[model samples]
Target: MTPPKTIRAAAIQVEARVADIPWNIEHASRLVDEAVDRGAELVALPEFFTTCIVYDERVFGCSLPPENPALDMLKEKARRHRIHIGGSYLEMRDGDVYNTYVFVEPDGKVHRHDKDLPTMVENAFYVGGDDTGLMETSLGPVGAAVCWETVRTQTVKRLRGKVGLLMTGSHWWSEPGWNWARGYWQRFHAGNGRLMERTPRTFASLIGAPLLHAGHASVIEGGFLVLPGTRLTAPIRTQLMGETQVIDGEGRLLARRRYQEGAGVAVADLQLGAVQPRAESPPRFWIPKFSPMLYFQWYHQNAAGKSAYRWAKRTGRLRTWDDGRNARAAAERL
Candidate 1:
C-alpha cells in the first residue's frame, strides 16, 4: 500500500500511577485529548501506560481482558478524536497474562501485539508473545516494540521490511546507585541529552524507518509509584528517566522530550511516503546476525525461565512484594 505524504504523530510522555487502573485510564485519555487538540492524527503512549511497570500483586490481581474498560475508553477516545491510539496493558489471554500493546483506529478497530521479550524480572508476571508483525493502519504499515524490545537487534531487523512507521513504547528507569559522578547517573544528569539521544536514532538508521518512541518520565521507585506503604519520603530522583524521541527515516532527530520535562504531547511530522527502503543493503563485515546473549535470555525467559524464577522465589534468591492482592494465586491459575 502507498503511504501518506505526511502525518502528525504524537509521543505522549506522562506520569503513570502504578496499579491505579481507573485513574491511569483517565489520565491517558486526557493526554490523548491534548494530542488531538494539537492535530495529531497518530498518537502513541508509553509502555504499560495503563499500569506503571510493576511486579506487585495488585497488577497481577487485577489483570483485565482485551475488551476491558480501559481499552473501551481508548476506543471511544480514538473514535471521538478521529485519530489512532497505541499503547499497552496487562492483558489476560488463554489463561495466561501477557503484556499486550493495543493499536486502536479511528473506526474503533483494534490490533493487538504482545511483548515478545519481557525485560528483567518481568518474566515472572507475564508470558512472552510468539508472533511479531506490522499493523496495517490509516497511517500506513505501523509497527511497535515495547521497552527493551526496541534494543533487540533481531526484533528491529524483523520490522525493517515490514513497516513504515515504527512507534515504540518504553519505560527506562534510573540505574542503581544514582550519584553525580558515576555511571548512568552522570550520563543522564549532565550529558546534554546525548546519552538518551543515541538509542532511537540508532534504531531508525538500522531499520531505515521513521520512529516515534513514547516513554514514561515520572519518578517510579521500583516502577511502582502509587503502591501503598512503599512510597519514598525523599524527593523523587530524576536520573535515567526516559525520553520521547522522533527519529526520521534518515536517522535524524525530528523532535524529542527530555527527562522530567513538563508532561504533555511531543508531536512530529513524518513523510511516510518518503521513508527509505524497507531493508538497507547488508554491511560488508559478516558480523554475527544476532546477539547470542539476548537470544539465550529470551529462550530461558519463555517457559524454562519461569521455572527457574519459581525456584528463586522458593529459595529466597528473589523477594516477593505482595500487595495483598493474591497475585501469586492469580498468576498460578493463569
Candidate 2:
C-alpha cells in the first residue's frame, strides 16, 4: 500500500497536575488513543509531559544522571495505541542529564531530541542538548521545540526545512490580564488572546505546517492576583493548553479548536507540499536558501566567542566593556 500524501497529526493536551505520574501517563495515553481513532499517524505531547513544571518535584528525585522513565512509559503507550506518541522528558546518558523528548512509533521504534538550547530555568535543571529542532519518523519529518527554543532565530530557521509537520511542547506562560477572584477568571481568559497571541500565530506563519503548543492549565504557587487592584502574596504560574490547529502556507488558520485540559486530541490532516516552491516570496526565518557561514561571521564579529575573548584578552578585547577597565585602558593607549 502506498503511503498517504497528507498525514493526520494530533496534538495532545492535559491539565497536568504536578507529580501525578500515573495520572499524567493515563491522560496523555488517552489522547493518543483518540488521535489514532481519528486516523492520526502522528501525535505529540507537551514539553516534559511526564514531569510537572521543572520546579515541581526535581524530576521525581532524579539526580545528575537522570532516568528516562517517561520514555519507557511513552513507548508502552505508543505500542498500546498502535500510533506514534511523543513528549518531552528527562534523559540520562554518560552521566549527564538533559531535557529531552523521545518519540516512540507504533512498531516500538524510538527517536529522541534533547532541547538544543536549554532555557535559563532549564539550564539549571538539565545540561544543554546535543541537537536542535525536529525528529524524523516513518510518516514524515516531524520537528519539535520546547518553550523559548522555538523563538530562536537559528532554531526556527532549522524547523522550516523539508520537515512535514511542526510540533512544539512549551511551558510558555503568560499573565492572563485581570482577575478579581473565582468569578474573575472568565474575564482573564477572555483577554488571554490579546496577551499571548503573538508566538502561536508565528508558528503557523513561519512553518507552513500544523503546529501544537501544549501547556498546563492549573493554579500554580503564588499565582497572579484575582482581584483587580489588590496585591497578591505570591506570584502564581499557570498555563492553558492551546488548541491544535492547521495552517496553510499562506499563514491562514485552516482549523482551530478550544484549548482543552482533558484526555483531549486535536486532529488535522496536513498536506505540506501544497504550500511550497513560491515564486516571489521573500525569505523569512527558514527560507529555501539559507547560509550558515554568513552567520558564523555574524556571530564571530557581533557576539562573544570564548576563543575570541581569550585571544582578545591578550590583544585587548575592546568591542564593549561593562567593567570600564578595558575601555579605560584602551583610552589611555589612544
Candidate 3:
C-alpha cells in the first residue's frame, strides 16, 4: 500500500538520567503527549530513552527483559493515541544485552531492530545484531536505526531505495571532561557539533527517504577506562549531542531541536516516499570522517569496553533485567 503523501511526525528530544528508569519514563511520556497534541501521527524517541548509556555498572542494571515496562509504555502510548511510537532501549535476551529499537503501531503490532554495532564505551553493555532495520508497516516500508548506525555507509546500503521512511535515534556524546587542554577540547567539541547537526539531512539524502531522528539532551556522569585490563577508572563528565530533527528524502530540513535548546519535540509534516538517491554510498565504513581524537577513542574504548564486558559476564557482575528492575523497585520503597 502507498503511504499517504504527507504525514505529521514528531521527534522527541529528552534529558534522560543515567539508570533512572521511572523518571525517564515519566519525562518521555509527557513529551510523547506533547507530540500527539501537536497532531503527530508518528512519534519517535531517542536511543536509550529509559536510561542514558554510560560506562557505569548502574547502566548495565538498566537493561529490560523482552516484556518490560519501557516497551509496555510505548505500546500503551501507541494504542492510546492511535499513533505510531518507538525508541531504543537496552534489552536482555539469551543472557546477552542488546540496544534494541521497538516500534509499535496503533493496533498493537510491533517491530524491533537491534543496533548493528555498539559505539565506544557502549560496547561494554550490549552485543551487536545482524538483522536489517527494514520493516513493513501499515504505512509502507519503514526503517529503524540507532546512533552511529545512522552515520555508517553500510546502513545506507541496506536501506536505500527500500524504505519510504527512516526512523532513527542517537545517544551521541561529547568528549568527557575538558579540564586538561581546555582550548583543544573546546575546538574538538565545536567541530563535532557541526557534524551532529548535519547528520540527519545528509543521511536522508543518502537513503532517499524522509527521516525522523530523536536524540538525548543532558549531561552524563560516568567513568572512562584508564587501561584495558584493570578496573581503574577516570571520572568523566559529558553531555549528549542532541539533534532531534525531521528531514525530507531530498535532504531538506523540516524541523529541528538543537542540544542547547534542551528537551522538546520537533514536529513537522513529512513528505514520505522513496525518491532518487541524492548521494552515492561511499566505499568506506563511516560516512563522516572521524577526527584523531574520535578515531583513537573509538578503537581504544571498544577494546577496553569489550574486555570489561567479558569480565562482568564471567564474574556475574552484569545485572539481568529482572535483577535490575527488582533492585530499583526495592530502592524506591526504602
Candidate 4:
C-alpha cells in the first residue's frame, strides 16, 4: 500500500467563556464555518467547546444526551456544511456523565470516545473513561483523545496502523498561581510540556502521514498547529484567530505570531511529498522507546487513590455502577 498523505489542519485558538454552553456552542459553530470557508475538510474546536471550561460537577450538570439540542444542532451543522467536527462534549449516559469527544461526520453521523485520564482537578467530579486509543472516522482511521488523556491513553503502540489521523482535544486549565506552577511543571518535566506535544506529530511521521493537531489552546494561552511534513514546503501558515504558527510533525515550532487574536486561517498541500521513514532505525516516537508494557505495569501499582477507587468500581463489588446519587446514599444506609 502507498504511504499516508499530508492533511491540512486548523486549530481554533478561541476564548471560551466559562460556564456558558450556548455561547460556547455558537462560538465553536462559528469556527467550524470559518474553517469550511478556508477549505478545511476536518476542523477542530478546543476541548469542551460545547460548554465553558466546565470542570468538576459543572461538566456533569451541563451534560446532555447525544440527541440533546446542543449536539443535534452540531449534527445539522456538520451535515449542511460538509465538515467533520473534531472535539469532545460533556455527555450524560446511563444516568452518569462523561467527558466525551465525538467525531461528527459530514453525513451527520457520529462516533464517540471518552477521556482516558481525568486531570487531578477533574478527579473530584469525573469517573475515568475506560476505553483507550483512537476511534475510526470517514476521513481515515482517526484517533480522538482529550488532553491529559494522551499520557496513559495507550502508549503509542495501539496508535500504530490503527489510525492515519490523530485528532486530540485538550481542555487544559491553568491559573497563574501556585497550583498552576505545580501542575505545569509536572506535564512539562514528565509529559515533555511543549515538546511532548509532538507525540501525535511523531506518530504521523512514523506511519508516513501528516497530523491534523487542533491543540485545545484558547484564550489565556493562545493556540498552535504542527506540520513537520508540510514545513519543508512552507513552515509558516495562518491559523485560527488571525494567528500564525510553524510547527513540526514532532510538535516543534519553527515560527509563530507572538500575540494575535480574533480567528486566523492556514492551509497545507496535504498531498505533499512522502514523509520518509528511517531506513534502519527503531521507532523513535515516545511509545516505542519507552518500554510501555513495564511502565504501565508500575503505573497502576502507584496510581492515585482516585484511580484506584475507580478501578474497584469497574472491576469489583461495585461493578454494576449506578449514577443516582440517591441510590448510593440508600445503599449506605442499608
For every candidate, C-alpha RMSD to the true structure in Å: 7.1, 13.9, 1.8, 11.3
Best of the two (1, 3) by TM-score: 3
lDDT against true structure, model 4:
0.50
lDDT of 2 by residue, 1-334 (tens): 1133666777766666555555676767666677788887767787767555433322323321233445666677677767677778655566455667777788888877788765433433455676755666776777777755655556656666456566676654433323446455554455544333445556555655556555544444423222222222234455544544445445555545445444466677755542342222234543233235334423432222222223333443222112233456789999
As for candidate 4, its clashing pairs are 6-270, 88-101, 228-249, 238-265, 239-264, 240-264, 241-263, 241-264, 242-263, 242-264
Q: Candidate 4's residue-wise lDDT over 67-87, tens digit each? A: 665677668768887767667
lDDT of 1 by residue, 1-334 (tens): 4655688889888787767777888888898888888889888888888766543444544457656877888799889888888888777766566878889999988888898867754665567897674788776787777877766666765677567778787876544333445664554344424535566776677666788888787765443222222322222343435688877788888888887684678888876733565344355321124345335434543444355335434544342122223456798889
Question: Each candidate's TM vs. the true structure?
Answer: 0.76, 0.65, 0.96, 0.63
Report backbone clashes per prediction. 0, 7, 0, 10
Worst 10 residues of 3 by lDDT: 319-328
Query: Considering every candidate listed, which one attains the maximal TM-score?
Result: 3
Error of 3 at 297 (Å): 0.7
**What's the TM for model 3?**
0.96
The TM-score between candidate 1 and the true structure equals: 0.76
